[model samples]
Target: MSWNIFEKLKTVFMKVTQILVKLFKKTNKSTSLTPVSNVIATPTAHYEGVQTATIIAIPTNIAKAVVNCCLKNRIDLAEAIFRGFGYGNTKIVVTEKEIIAETSSGIVLLDPSKYRLSEL
Candidate 1:
């Protein structure tokens, strides 16, 4: 038993910290086995208008406070009072019947005919 240089630098620093904690636990168990490997599974709702683009999860400041409370209660009564409160979630809720143009540069437009709620 004759080691010493501080036990050969503490056995090469415990075999380089056990090979860096087994390479960070095998890269966190291969990233928890592909938790949605590329993650793009949430599409399928495109009818464009009378509402149906819901993909909610909630929090883009509570979905822009439910799209500014359905754009202040009258864009078709806030598009029938915005409702897409989560069921799968990736954040989407487009109810477009918008058509409010008044653009010289003051910019106030929508689409489908027009919507100008006095250029909010």
Candidate 2:
């Protein structure tokens, strides 16, 4: 029995697709760069004579990575990563929101009061 040319081509294509999928998944998927044990909350600044709430803005990717690491390691790595990035003292944090409300002027509607922090 002889295999046709189409069969050979199909087999090659399937192998190539499998390789590409594995490579892409390994590269795109999150992995812990620095070990979670080394992370710590280093204070950046202290506001004097005023009441303030610290809002740490972290990269979405990094935040997701931290969550993944924590889940795997069962440690609170997210807070450590946030503090390590110098978010110990600041207000008006920034992040990408999935549900966005925009007007004609392209202004993002971010009403913090609408969403209670305690619930989050």
Q: Using lDDT as the measure, which candidate wins?
A: 1
Clashing pairs in 2: none
- Candidate 2: 10-residue stretch with minimal lDDT: 98-107
| Model 1, runs deviating above 4 Å | 1-42, 48-57, 71-73, 77-91, 96-120
lDDT of 1 by residue, 60-84 (tens): 2223333344455433323332432
Candidate 1 accuracy as lDDT: 0.32
In order, what is each prediction's RMSD in angstroms? 25.2, 20.1
TM-score to true structure, per model: 0.20, 0.22
Residue 2 CA displacement from its true place in model 1, Å: 86
Question: Could you tally the backbone clashes for each prediction?
Answer: 8, 0
Candidate 1 versus truth, CA RMSD in Å, comes to: 25.2
In model 2, which runs have C-alpha deviations exceeding 4 angstroms? 1-3, 29-120
